[model samples]
Target: MADDKYYTLAEGCPFANNASAVLMRGKQGSGLGLLQDTQLIETLAHFSRERIPERVVHAKAVGSYGEFEATRDCSDFTSASFLNKVGKKTPVLQRVSTVGPESGSADTSRDVHGWAMKFYTDEGNQDFVFNNTPVFFIRDPLKFPSLNRSHKRHPQTHLPDANMFWDFHVGNPEGIHQLLILFSDRGTPKSVRYMHSYSGHTYKFTKPDGSFKYAKIHVKTQQGVENLSSQEATRIAGEDPDFMIRDMFEAIERGEYPTWNIYVQLMSPEEAENYKWNIFDMTKVWSHTEFPLQQIGRLTMNRNPQNYFADIEQAAFSPSTMVPGIAASADPVLQARLFAYPDAARYRLGVNYQQLPTNAAKAQVYCPFQRDGAMRFDDNYGGDPNYVGSWIKPTKFYQDAKGIRASALALHTDHEKWVGEVSAYTSEITDDDFVQPAALWEVLGRVSGQQDRVIENLVGSLTGVKYPELRRAVYSLFGRVNNNLGFMLQERTEAVIKTVQN
Candidate 1:
């Protein structure tokens, strides 16, 4: 017996299997299409509206379904159920993408990669919107748009402008560390499976008692770190624009699952007060020697999405999608992202985007207050009061394992007492900012030919800057990182510029 179902219209009205168009035929075998063909009209209309808005950044990505297994209990640090017991597992969706590139852009482009993961836990959904690098371009929230714009196309030229890129970095010198790393081999990972990821912003892992410790999450690739050189990446981009995406998909298809060890560098509030660098600074990394990496879990991607557009493309993640016991810190850039990410999702997908299958929480949710938006499919909390504090239908609330209502928890120990005073504030450049980049430079030098590769990559891009002043400013910016780096960039960049001019 045939098991196949007959193909039909979207509304389930089955039509005869025949030529789609209804045409008025003449004796000469010529025909004019009739306007009454519902099938043809519907197909065209749906095709026109097929695509949703692509992400402004990290537009191109490879996603996978995975499991995060708790390797070590973290009950002392966080009461998050997913990490509270050994051998416990949580379902996860992972997406790794190149920043500043469109959906059709080359996967091997020299750029930062975004590593976003969503954990479907018992409490709710938790998202780790991370980066391959441990630090970011800027720490200040206000510079976010400017930083992205500088990396994107020039308004008038509609092309990537090296002058704009260099000028922004030179002006905002705190990004030197990230720039140096970006120009290095690490910027071009061989595949998404081979690169490590980090939570660039410090987060808080709170216990049930309202006590929390600052944390920077790190996920080291079990497949090991593998990167492509500038020449190799360029060749791959020309040869196979979707190289990384294909690599991941084929690997999973062959049962070669990619895995990562999750760890966190944790610091107490008391320790953060005396730390050398500000814990909230997104541009700086917490030293492993100082805080130390504590193992939490292991993540393994074992499944591929059956449909990319529905399962991966529509999936939304935000830093604000925190479960109980895991929360955001006071990092300015992180604070901005918490708002920006959800807002962008609402605009790109819809206000009801969370109702989509991929983005919905596995745990039960009861937010009647968030009802009645575009594409709202569920019952709008039938007969239940939308507003809070209704005596007629009092809503049930959750309590922790200790039987204490989460809402009644004491104020956080790190909460600041305010005096109703406000002042204008902006992060200023200081010698401290360059300290990490200089150290990273020295570390790069320790690897054979790594420093030269960095210099070559810098010169390759820096040579595109038509303005001599901008080139000089970039050299000065590097000089702050290391005198040798500054000299090499200046000499190599100018030599290339002159050769190109001649």
Candidate 2:
């Protein structure tokens, strides 16, 4: 019977033994082995290649399968077929991960979480690669790699250096708003299931008639936001490194799946033309009061992976995997990601990474030219013409789209050409950047002990800084946000540092 089966080789051939391999050796195993066994060689070779390259940032993650159901018609906003009709369901694969850790790092580490969703829609795969925080540390695309590297370990020490982290932030105080939020409770989410995700960069919702609007996506957790304190997170990180992943799996096994309500804040071209802040800035968030959230769909994660390595590990999500009617805004960071992410995946996986079952789109793709790469999957379009405009056996083309540019796919900027003097787009901190952060501080003050909690949390982490100058600069940066909060943070942090030093 199939149930009463014994183990065999990968090719289904019966093996000599399952536990051990036969090896010819000299007497008393003191001399070199003269003969080599095929099974032993194959087993050792396969074992050496068992691991794949891990993700650079979000190396530790948990994946789940789900379905997204459109709850409201968004036809007026965009022509994307996935959101045009209510109750339409699309299969989704999602992975939530800790951003700044290795493959074996703890899930409860105090870091931002990467929230990625891949929608296998009829039009193709659309990937929404988001983060738990709405804002980021930098607005300039060039500084992205530097900001991430600063958060990582040092080259000389080979360990995470707090002085390096604070040095970067001190030099670029424009990240003060994101820094404040990161040191708060929100940064240490208790579970991925209980946290919301936001598209940090502005995107586009395009219409068929070449009209488009700037939009930002937000997905609020239906389970509501929950967080672990820094101390608690540290304890769990040491006690059970896989606590969050285990909890999510156990919750799903008990039929309590996690869900999030998807919404988008849209800005008309006219409104964007007159907006106070740059609409394309990734470090800023549009006020919800001005642009209310328009609910579109719901995402529910119901199934865990059958095979972690195949279904979860090999899954790839990139900003370039966009479908029709949904385009990217001219946000510099976003434009950089559109080029960077897919390239990184090609390096990690093979060039034909998209052909993997977990990454392939459910929609029909007929690109014959993108072929003959490493790990080539599929039939290579199966005897179809690889080149275009073949006279002997010409490939049929869509007459409407052939040589005709899709006008709606173009980015919708206010002016068609350059109207202002060309200058470098650099990030500089001013009193204006502090306004939002000050408002956030006041809002936190309203809640009993929330301000204290944030201050305490900041003080605790600030103790990691060994350099007094860097610590002092950190205080000054927060001082720009608020006079009292910064002074208090300095006082408390210095006191703690002194105590530990003594």
Candidate 3:
């Protein structure tokens, strides 16, 4: 070990030739030395334990610190203190990620984009874990894990199987809405700064007295929605896997801060009852015409994190972590996620994951009973009882807003029957599913070479499907979207695969 050159136990050393130390001779038993054996064991030990557990989903991401300032008053919908006054500003930690991909996957991969934000409001932390797409693959929570698993590498093959991905979508036809969005150019965002974000899940804006209005949030990027073609995305993936991550870091460093216009779509409880589609359904979007977006605020990412792992990797967010004015909806997918997210953080980090610096709230969090777990950095609620129901120590409200008023509520009748069973109920392919997709197809056609590229990109995936039935199901699904699209896709796939084999 030299002073100038760092010491290596043969384990951490950057050796030019590791195999040179091994004893190889015709008559090794004559003069074998044990000194040469120690180096091999040390090298093997270090290599074995290098990896940690990967995230279940949304592993590939880029994050930033930003400020959200209210542009107008939204007091009618919710008594949330943050939105009560004009020009109110709150610090936000935003993370954008690609869903269903490994941490090493390309930023421009064809996948659903995540836009998870944690607002450090005065009341507490408000988490908005949303996707770039307005709608989701499935409305039911039961379909979630399966949907993610299908997108992941196949258990047996250890490869991304096309059959698995298409099977899940075709079987759960409700995914048709999101599947269309996925195949579109929007799937491959040009840059993290150039893409828009959305609050796909319907949340409620409530008042102090427990009354609320259903709302959906949108964060449109000021830079505009820019996308890379499939060829460009593939080239960048090969050239620079961390292209989007590096782009954001350099942009912020150069003081070209990215900003988003925040908008909300509000609907009263009375209106939801008569709405055409289920308001609680994550797969369905509230018609923009019916529930127009209203300007609310602006979010600008001005600062970069000092440390990537501490600030980004350790950050945890959940839709359940709502403040006074913001609350969860009865949406089945959202309701299920409320429990799943925090539980995931607990398992991934620890029971007291929130105690971590990035996840911790600015507001005082006093829960004595939840003390003393692995990595419990804080004092275990000194001199206080671990169990609840102590007469002397009464529980206190999380926030106290004197002037904040509760929202007006519509009449409520006990309709417990609506709370239905969770089953494998696929979506019916009505004409409605194709309407938006058709409009999108026309837009693609407007762009030179885009229609041909769309077909080429889709066929590249479709041709890899091993199962004939699954392939036809996919063709049939697209056929419902447009007869011409179905025929073109089938013809293109067959021809491309044939050329490769020949």
Highest lDDT against the true fold, candidate = 1
What is candidate 3's local distance difference test score? Answer: 0.81
The segments of candidate 3 whose C-alpha lies over 4 angstroms from its true place after superposition are: 1-52, 390-432, 442-449
Q: lDDT per model, in order?
A: 0.89, 0.86, 0.81
How does candidate 2 fare on TM-score?
0.93
TM-score of each: 0.95, 0.93, 0.83
The digit string of per-residue lDDT tens for model 1 on 177-275 reads: 899899988988999999999998999999867678889999999999999999999999999999998999999999999999999999998999899
Residue 450, candidate 1: Cα error in Å is 0.4
Clash tally, candidates in order: 0, 0, 2
Query: Whose lDDT is higher: candidate 1's or candidate 2's?
Result: 1
Q: What tens digits encode model 2's per-residue C-alpha lDDT throughout 326-438? A: 88888888998999989998999889999999999998776776888888967887765576656643555532435423344334534223457878987887778888889
- Candidate 1 has a TM-score of 0.95
* 10 residues in a row with least lDDT, candidate 1: 397-406
